[model samples]
Target chain A: MSTNAAKNLFIYGSLLCFVVLVILTIDTMGKLDKRAPEITEEVNAGKKVWHKYDCIGCHTIFGNGSYFAPDMTKATERKPKEYLKKFLLDPRVIKADSAMPKLGLNEQEADDLIAFLDWTSKVDTNDWPPKPILASAIAGKAASAGQALFQKHDCSACHQIQGIGGAAGPDLTQVGARRPDIDWHIRHLKDPSSVVRDSAMPAFTDMNDEELKALAEFLITLK
Target chain B: MKYQSHQIALNFYTTSVLLFLVQVLVGIIAALQFIWPDFFILNFNTIRTLHINSLVVWLLMGMMGATYYVVTEESETELWSVPLGHLQFWATVIAVGAVVVGYIVMGLNPQANTEVFGTRLLNEGREYIEAPRWADILIVISVLLFLLNSFMTVMKTRKFTAVQGVLLGGLTFLALMYLPGMFYTKSMVKDQFWWWWVVHLWVEGSWELIAAALLAFMLHKLLGTDVKVLAKWMYIEVGLVLFTGILGLGHHYYWIGTPEYWLWVGGIFSSLEPIPLLLMVWDAFRTTRETRVPVQNRIGLYLTVAHAIFNFVGAGLWGVIHTLPQVNKWTHGTQITTAHGHLAFYGAYVLLIVAMIYVTVPSIRGDKEFNQSRGFQSFWWMTISMVFIVITITGAGMVQTYMERLLGLDYVTVKATYNLWFWIFRAIFGAGFLVGVLMLAADIFSIGKRPAS
Candidate 1:
């Protein structure tokens, strides 16, 4: 092609692309405006709080921050509203080992932040930050016995069950599905260092066979 | 070396290399943080902000320096104001330095105490363009001064090559695109939308023009190729890039609260983004084949060729891989994105800038060549390390996608599963990349030992 012709094509093509982008952007703006939750003054204030604190520095909203923390796109749905409020006020209070430092937000600021999160949770993310499915079947009496044992042992201190506990250890909400081998669980709990060499979990050597079996059974039902 | 004002470029290049080293060091810290979260008391966010901002600043400095060298040489005149160029360079360096220091200081302080100061002194926490408002203003001023210096030189000479014109035009657009990033929008969607305008447009849009012009100028000089033919190819490449890249902004809009039509627009347009890159590769090879002159500066040729080929794979192929909405849904905001980012930046911008440095610095300093073995070793070390880095990260991303997105595993669980890949990425690839950078630095700085060609 002639140089002039190529230059002309470049200009024309660029114009065309620009026109299409403008149209698409306008269309997207309309759709997003419609899909977006009505931003009340409170929500707007909450958004300011989110930015003022630079929540995005750690937590991702709509999949856009450092991956050190959880994706808060669906934080509202993932946990109880009260749980979120309390956690926001003091993360360490909820989970003593949470990596999230207390941002020292006031009551209003905390509430506004929650409101902002609530608004973001309503955005159409194409069903992202997928919800974890809990096991539906109820555990038999042994599993109940395990739950009692879990509470008695204060397992929530180091491990998260469902979304409420320390983040120091892995969440055991899906431990049953992840590790189907009950034998591995029993061995891990008893010695804590047998399966994983660098495991920080303290051994529950004091628990008798019955308690260990019950705890393993209860964990197996977490799927 | 040829022009008296070319010394200005040396200052920029020196600072560019220094900043590049700092960027890599911070990048290593950021990468290591992913494997061992408690490795340092410093926040990963702060390290990451430093890494990305330094990359952008250093690359821009390199581009500015390269443009000055090329325009001065092509116009056959001294710079309009060498002192102004120095002023702009120092302004940029100080602004960038201040921002980095602010991040470190704020990161150490309590968030509550620094919240207000953060808006002015500390960063805004936006990715890529995270500079505070004051720093952003300083950058805009520096860019204007830079544009004025180049524009005045071109105007005074009244001798404009097609290569120079394309580069100047690209730089002009680069400054204009950056304006959108300064505006604060309340809507997250709109904020993100404009953010890509700066990020995507700069990388895939204007920067490609700059890269092509540099490549064409270098090729014409090195191979004695017809400037007419090289200019025509450059024109075509620029056209193709702008046509696709403008709409290619859609690819980032997906799932960011934008409408669904972006899926179609972004997917279709961005898939074509690589066409211009592929043409660049073909142009480089074909021009070399058609050259009557034997290639002198083999390392320069090697870097140019490597830039073209790697750009095709990194920016073109990997970019298209996830451009599709179906694919992006799974890969968005994952290590897959990181994999593409590392390769694309390294392949296109980083390599192109380095290639320019290699070709221009020798002539500027009156050196014939650096040690060829050192050049080749650094080239392979960097190249091989980059390839493995991309591969390892891509593997980790795909696994995370399957386990977390597909199987609904927890994010932390999926991340923990990829500890091995992260380790490889840090210990081997990261170290190799740093070593390669040091070797390149040594090769470039080793002066007066070799005889002039």
Candidate 2:
């Protein structure tokens, strides 16, 4: 009886040791990243650069950033390329304290990043806060020039994104998902919603059709 | 001090001590499994079953013992069937032993050609313990005997006092309500359906009735409060319990395939269930505040406070948090549910029963003030223990919930994360509760012939 008991105990202990070894080996062997490295690397690298420039410190995206600067969340929602290229060169025309010191850029990297942002805002994020806006913001291919026009008109003074703030305006993170189309936005930019009874965005009828389209297209996709 | 009947009080101490000991062992094993997942020859899943099932058993045993004390005295009769009580006492012991043994079989069964995560190994937990549905049937039978014995006593007397009625009703509910368990097919929806009928109904429904009358009886008997006033409160308390109680089962139905209507029902009504329990506690303090009764068995007094603390922890906070279907959506089947289960079971039901024992056991000696200070000191001890239990269990559950649900961490990883903390928490609480039980035992049995002083 004693020998049998001892034999049983040894068998159980050995079995336990053996099982642990197998599980550990299987776990290590199956370790895999599963996502394509190149695309992931590019996106992750852009996120790091975006974080470092502290672009978010001055300009808001997805409703976070400093209040004094224009919200760049709608940068991809542009209608004209000329509006973006012209404004990137002249920062002060947008605001007096436009604390947005002109960060000089060659058009190539600028276009890539704007394209990246455009791609990001169009992903189907369901109803969660970050994903949908990021998906659409990345998709608004021509919205950059219009983004520049809104800043030129000093819309940054009233609005905020990601967390940067303007005291007087509405958040435009998912506004592409929230509001009506370009005609309404342009006419609203031309008149206050009170006079218009439909637009809180002061009307920008004063701007030429190209600038109006830039701003209108940007606001339209927000919802 | 008002006189308490001693025969009733003695029964309480014997049961409370046994329960505390069971908890200590269960806590130790639960810790061991965490310390090493394959701690035993088998798996953590089987280990988890033993831990939870033992907890349910010991707690039920303790509560039944406490009810025995309250009912026997309140009816103004010697226990109507002491023999049946003893029979029940042995049946419970065997049932508990059977469950523990069954789990071991459940664990070791996984040993046959087992590899981790193998479905074959996993099936062993259910298969080896293919306890003929007879095991649960046995438990129900034991409860039926207890119910029959208790109810028959009420019929023979042809009188039901507030305390006897509540205690009788509780025992009957414990027995009859389990009828749902028989119809419980293995589907998650059906199982959860009837499981909550027994679980929810016993804890929140009939159990509340017992707590009120027991509290009223003990206070009126010990502190000299008017029974009539307490009885009126008991009436209101039972109404409020049932009014909120039946609907309170809606909380369980929330996550199950039951219609979304249960969300509206459970979310609203079950949240309201704690009000009466809280009101009863307030009434205890307020009614007793005006009268000062010199006391015997201060251990019993301390047990009363332990009772109130655990009642709040187990049935109150735990009940309220998981009452909503949305919260239950994530917390259910996770450690969050376990945390609430432990604190609520031990703190509320288990502690109240212990307190009832503390009050009644010393009555037979006809001494109002024998060993008063020690009992009160133990009361603080038990209260502090319950606080540790509720806090730690809640923390452990929350960690598990976040890991498994929010973080999407798999089961093994989630269990490993808070495994150490559960052991540590159970150790401290288990030790403290055991100490309180020991102190209570001395008061009930009386350590040394009362010093002739």
Which candidate tops DockQ? Answer: 1
| Model 2 score (lDDT) | 0.55
Q: Tens digits of per-residue lDDT for model 2 on B253-345?
A: 543334455578778888887887676777767766766777555556555655665676577777788777666666655545556666676
Give the chain B TM-score for each candidate: 0.96, 0.82
Q: At residue B346, what lDDT does model 1 achieve? A: 94
Q: Per-residue lDDT tens digits of candidate 2, residues A46-83? A: 33234323343334343222221333444544322333
TM-score of each: 0.86, 0.59
Which model scores highest in lDDT? 1
Candidate 1 at residue B419, lDDT?
46
Q: In candidate 1 chain B, what residue range of length 10 has the lowest lDDT sum?
A: B112-121
Local distance difference test, per candidate? 0.79, 0.55
Among all windows of 10 consecutive residues in model 2 chain B, the one with the lowest summed lDDT is B119-128
